[model samples]
Target: MTDTLALAGRLLLAALMFAGTAQKLASPTEAQALLALASLPPWLIWPAALFTAIAGIGLALGLATRPLAILAAAYCVVTSTFHVLMDDPWQMTIAFKNWVIAGGYLLLAAHGPGRFALRRD
Candidate 1:
């Protein structure tokens, strides 16, 4: 039961993150605007966006979940901190969402994906 729930949670978060990354890719201008609002440099936006997309796919597929989760957690923390510190109203919700995702990633990192993951042997 716990494994099922965790798997579901991971899938949902992965989908959400992937969607976000897609949006960034589809509309770089919009993404850059948001990043600017958060005071992030323009050069860093593309790399961050790419990593988020790849990490989301990795998490969804249960491949390298530990390292990917750690990377995602770190990215979430940095992005959330940027949002909070910049006082971006549009990003406040994202900041909270990132924190939640960070917690989920950390949990997965510590516990592994159990039997529900694709990588389970």
Candidate 2:
């Protein structure tokens, strides 16, 4: 069912974002290196980490799924742009991931969270 698929996708993305945030938190130096490679402002590093973690938690719980997905999609877009600018061939991977995530977000945004969502009031 579409609901099942969406839930699975949302959970997967949440896990991915959580892992990324953990990496950033556990190894800030590595995070800094990647951010530097992306040319993102150093000050943004911590805020970005926090946003990703919070958004991931929200999406996983199906709470404000649409808005959180949108925020996550925006974050993915920003990071994808940086990867593209870096000329990393991995950018292609990031692009596809971002696109899929954005699609999921758009679907949730349009369809509400379907059944099985916390907001299914």
Candidate 3:
């Protein structure tokens, strides 16, 4: 049961990351605009999107789960901070959601990916 729950959680989180990656890819202009607003270089969009997509895949497959989860959690923090800094009510929701995802990622990191995962550590 615990393994099942962990698997379920991992799948859901992967789905979330994949969705975000798709959104970014589907609208690179918009994503680039957001990056510009964040004072980041536009060139970062490609690498960021690629990392996100690959990380989502990695998470789903339970490959390098610990470090990947940590990186995902750190990404959540980075994005959450960006939204929080925006100071808009609408952006606040995204920030909140990122923090929640970060919590989940952190928990998964500490707990391992369970027996059903591809990688044990």
Candidate 4:
């Protein structure tokens, strides 16, 4: 039961990241603009989106669980911090969600991805 719950969480987080990936790809120009607002390079939009997509897949499949989870969590923290710095009221919710998602990843990291993980170590 615990393993099943953990798997469910992982898949849910993956789905969320996939949605973000799609959004990024759908509007790279807008994403680039936002990245610039955060003092980041516009060229990173594609690579950043790809990172999320790949990490999302790995998280769902339980492959490279620990490191991927950490990456996802770090991504969340960085993005959320940017959003907070930007102080966009409209995007504050997104920042909040990112932190919440990061918490889930942190928990997954601590829990060892449960029994359903493809890579136990």
Ten residues in a row with the worst lDDT in model 1? 81-90
lDDT of each: 0.78, 0.75, 0.86, 0.85
For 1-121, candidate 1 gives per-residue lDDT tens digits of 9888778877876786798788777877876766787777777778877898898887888878888888888888887865674456766887888898899889878887667777852
| Leading candidate by TM-score | 3
> Residue 32 in candidate 1 has what lDDT?
77
lDDT of 2 by residue, 34-111 (tens): 678776666677997898899888878888888887777777776766555345667677777777777766666667
- Model 4, which residues run further than 4 Å from truth? 85-87
Distance from true position, residue 96, model 3, in Å? 1.4
Q: Which candidate do you rate higher for lDDT, 2 or 4?
A: 4
Candidate topping lDDT: 3
The count of residue-pair clashes in candidate 3 stands at 0
- True lDDT of residue 110, candidate 1: 83
Error of 1 at 56 (Å): 1.3
Give TM-scores for every candidate, taking all chains together and pairing residue i with residue i. 0.81, 0.80, 0.93, 0.90
Q: Model 3 segments beyond 4 Å from truth? A: 85-87
Q: Give the runs in model 1 whose Cα sits over 4 Å from its true position.
A: 37-39, 85-90
